[model samples]
Target: MIALDIENVTKSFGGVRALTGVTLSLNEGERLVLLGPNGAGKTTLFHSISGNILASSGRISLFGDDITQLPPDARARLGLARTFQITNLFAQLTVLENILLAVCGAQKLTFKFVRPLDRYDDIQKRARALLEEWNLVDAADRLVRNLSYGEQRQVEVVMALSGEPRILLLDEPTAGLSPAETLRVMEMVRKLPRDMTIVMIEHDMDVAFEIADRIAVMHQGRVIAEGDEAAIRGNQQVSDIYLGVE
Candidate 1:
């Protein structure tokens, strides 16, 4: 089944086009990567899909249901979750607390103030399990502000996964990581459930080739080439335009 469908999508800001007639479909459990140089509209495409930025033209559907007009929060409620290119966390909150907040947000309990957060034992249990799975249990009590850059990124990912999203959109998830840290993050990403659709924007060819079942190369706001990793690597157009290979 198709997890996400983008057809004829286009976006422009004040006469400057960021994306033009972009189209793609991601199947359930598919691990796809978007490859592009800087300014290639990779992030813009992610925003369009996640509803952070609305597409000026074209249709977006999740699991066969059109969500082109839905707001970002609404899309989140519909099983769409995304992590930003930069880490986003509640700096003042503990790692566990950050995950808890994400749980509350996903459950639409943001308005419930009278109830003690501890009232959700099941939620806490699940959050703890996620922390442990992501190797952040040891740092769960630490304030996000105090954790190392890589650790902070792990927390952000845990928070994104806390929602149990059906479709996961990760924007440059391995950005700012050292080579070792980048490999670690990619390993965790590879461990995600096979039923969840994942689409990530990555500039690291090694990382993208390692984890992506398929690759889509974006250049100047359009998909110039897309195929399995081997095919993409071999494509002359992809090599010349994006990979900078002769």
Candidate 2:
């Protein structure tokens, strides 16, 4: 079944066309990786899909519901989650506290200022479980600012997952990392339940090919080619535009 769809999507910023007439669909539980060189408009499409930015024109739907005009938080509440290219975390907050906040937000309890901390014991337990699930228990008490760049990225991912989203859009998930750190993140992604649909913008070919069941290649604000990994690898246009193999 199709879990997400983007139809006739277009976005422009002033005179620059970030995306032009892009369309794509993802099956439930499919792992799709968006690939492109710089200026390919991969991030723009991600923003449109995740509702971080409005599409200049098009329709976006999740599991058969139109959400093109929804805000980020509303889309998030609709079982869509995303992670930015940069780490978005509470730097001054401890890992556990940050996780608790995510859990609270997921449960819509963050606005209940009158509620006592004791009232959120279940959320606290779930937060600890997430920390343990990601092997972050050792650093749970440490401030996010004290964590390494790779660790911060890992935490950012877990935070996104805290909501148990049915569809997750990740932007440059392995963007800045040592080879080892990249591998670690890939392993984590690989172990996730297959019931969750994943769409990620990735520059790291190894990680992309390793995790993506389908690959979509973009160039100059358009998707140039999309297919299975083998098809993408042999497509001359993709190799020419992205790999620069003349």
Candidate 3:
């Protein structure tokens, strides 16, 4: 089944266009990596899909349902989750508290002012399960601000998973990590359920090739090449853009 369909999407900022007629599709449970030089419109496409920014022209569908007009929250409710290139978390909150808040938000329990959050057994259960399942119990009580950068990235991924999303968009999940930290994240991603579809933007060539079932190379607001590892590896345009090969 097609999990996401982005057809003829475009995004413009005043006189400049960030994405131009970008079209891509992902199958259910497939892993797609977006490869590009800086300013290739990778993040812009992500924003469009996640509803952070609306496309100037085109159609986006999630599971055959047109979601081009939906807001971010509405899309979240429909099983879409994403992580930013930067860490998005409550620095002062402990890991457990952060997970609790994410669970509450995902379940839309933030408006329940009459009931204390702790009183919600279901929410607490879900948070605890997430911590245990992700092997984050050891740092459950530590402040996010106190955790290492790599650990914080892992926490962000766990938070994204709290909603049980069918499709996940990750923007540079291992951007600033050390080699060891990168390996840890790669292992974590490898352990994800095979049923979850993932689309990621990665600058690390090794990481991109290792995790991607297919790759799409973007350059100057367009997808210039796409295929499996071998096909992408041999594409002259991709080589010219990234490796300066003739």
* TM-score against native, each model: 0.93, 0.94, 0.95
TM-score-wise, the better of 2 and 3 is: 3
**Per-residue accuracy of model 2 over 1-246 as CA lDDT, tens digit each:** 789999989999999999989999999999999999998999889888888889999999999889999888888877888889878899999999988888888877234354567658768888999998999999999999999888888898899998889998889877878988888888888888899999999997778888999999899899999998889989999878765763
Clashing pairs in 2: none
> What lDDT does each candidate get?
0.87, 0.88, 0.92
- Candidate 1 ranges beyond 4 A from true positions: 109-119, 243-246
Winner of 2 and 3 under lDDT: 3
Q: Pick the candidate with the highest TM-score.
A: 3
Per-residue CA lDDT of model 1 for 1-246, tens digit only, reads 999999999999988899999999999999999998888899999998888889999999999889998899888877889999877888999999999888867766234444565558767887888888888888989998998888787777778888789989889888888888887888889889989999999988888998888999998899988998789889888778754662
On lDDT, the candidate that comes out on top is 3
lDDT of 3 at 221: 93
Better of 1 and 2 by TM-score: 2
The best-first sequence of candidates by TM-score reads: 3, 2, 1
